[model samples]
Target: MFDEKNIWDTFRYGDESSFKLIFEQFYTPLFNYGHKFTVDDHIIEDALQDLFVKLWKNKDSIRETSSVKNYLYKAFRRVLLRKLSYAPQVVGFSSPEDKLDFNFQLGHDHTLISQERLQQIRQSLSDALKKMTPRQREIIHLRYYEEMEYEEIADIMQLSVSSTYKLLYRAIETLRNNLSNTDFLLLLSLLSLKKV
Candidate 1:
């Protein structure tokens, strides 16, 4: 019933309804994704406005992509980065973690696991995640939380496919080294959940 290609085509044809539909469907996810880059909510909102403006203005010239989400994300990232590039040095922090925050949704569905055990695992996983570099955390969030493919993740992050794979591999390895077997398994289960 939900046809992305049709919606994208309609949007490209300058249908305001299609644009509104796309905006409603993607705004929250885009906002969350942008939050990973900067803490300022105002800046993120401004960037989204700019992204949509450009999307509508240049729709006729935009190339068709297999995934509309991918196209939007790539454009959004480029716009946000360009805006940040000219901003003050105070915005350009030395550490990636300073700009990126890692607060995974990590909801609790206590069907199989006890609440106490889940809490314990959450705390341990949080500690292990803190050990990873911000880029590593970003990859993990894109792969697991966003449920994005490696290629899409690579495109969004401006990395090669193999580099994205290796980055995720190293991030997972870091978590494995830091967490106990049980905790690692629990974390894996949490990561496997579909984003709701």
Candidate 2:
């Protein structure tokens, strides 16, 4: 298996090859994560560039990480949040003032699927997610849609491991309360597609 920690350690020791590998490997995930906060491609690109540039400049000072992905996520989150704070009308995932952007679109193919059923699925998923607060929705996304461990989610969200578990449980409970058995299963099936 590819050892991300070893690669991270090599990069920390000033290896430019390892640096390039990490940047290339993490760029897509980091970009998607940044997009959760803002739709602006420019901001997302700038934040990613700033992250890699700063890492290269300060590589020697960076410490070894047991989980390289989590470390990068934690750092990238801070930088993105700072940029989003300065930008007007950009809502962060934890922002309660803004309505939850819990998108649940089902792309249509030229199959025999009916539009009415697709719309119903979309509406139910959205309705279930909208019942939760933005913070709750975020925790659910990070835990399920992102397929992240509790520790990793905690590091990125700046929450404790226990808090991460509690928040995820609460978020799921809220969804369960709002959705019927069939709708909840449908929602969960779609969310679990990330693991596939």
Candidate 3:
């Protein structure tokens, strides 16, 4: 029932209600998308808040978006990249086990899965993601988790559209190979059944 165009128009016309609506709709998804990049919750929170504040301040200059979701995601990705550039070196992976541990802790879902299964699935995905280069993981996160267009991702990562596609293709192949070695079929079955 939420009309994105109407909401944008209202926001452009200085309507607080429309801006509030947009924030409410996108807050969680954007947070989750940001989490896929960094383990720091405070950093993610600050980034999202700053991104929305900027959106409101620059409302008049905002272009017509084919998808509001994509617009928000692109903005979030840019903010995250800027934040990462300045963050401490400790933010980078220190070890494979450390990365896996952090990722498992970050993506663990208590409501969606039993603690044991959550740990197992989280470890599996974490290990797979850790095997990927930082750039590849960033691209995959932007494309799949954030749902940005390839062109937008290319602009964000400073790569050509074809290069972005190739990066994603290779990342997917790597993920498939890594995940395939685990109890991936069982995990998928559990995920599909909502019993994970």
Q: Which candidate leads the pack in TM-score? A: 1
The TM-score, computed over Cα atoms with residue i paired to residue i, of candidate 3 is: 0.70
Q: Please, what are the lDDT tens digits per residue for candidate 2 over residues 36-148?
A: 66667788898899999999899889888777888888898889889888876755544443344556657758277678668766666677676776567777777877899
TM-score of each: 0.79, 0.72, 0.70
lDDT of 3 at 192: 86
Of candidate 1, the 10-residue stretch with the lowest lDDT total is 90-99
Where in model 2 is the C-alpha error above 4 Å?
91-123, 181-196
Task: Kindly report which residue stretches of model 1 are placed more than 4 angstroms away from their true locations once superposed.
Answer: 89-112, 180-196
Worst 10 residues of 3 by lDDT: 93-102
Model 1 agreement with the true structure over 1-196: per-residue lDDT tens digits = 6588999898898999999988988899888877766676777788899999999999999776799898888888888777776665535323344344556455657799787777776766776676787678778878988899999999998999999999999999988887776566767877886443
Better of 1 and 2 by lDDT: 1
Sorted by lDDT, highest first, which candidate order results? 1, 2, 3
The residue-by-residue lDDT of candidate 3 on 1-196, one tens digit each, is 9999889888888899999999999999888776666777788888988998999899889887777876787788888778877786536332233533333345544787688777666767777777887677778778766677898888767789999989998888888888787776766777988963
- lDDT of all the models against the reference? 0.79, 0.78, 0.77
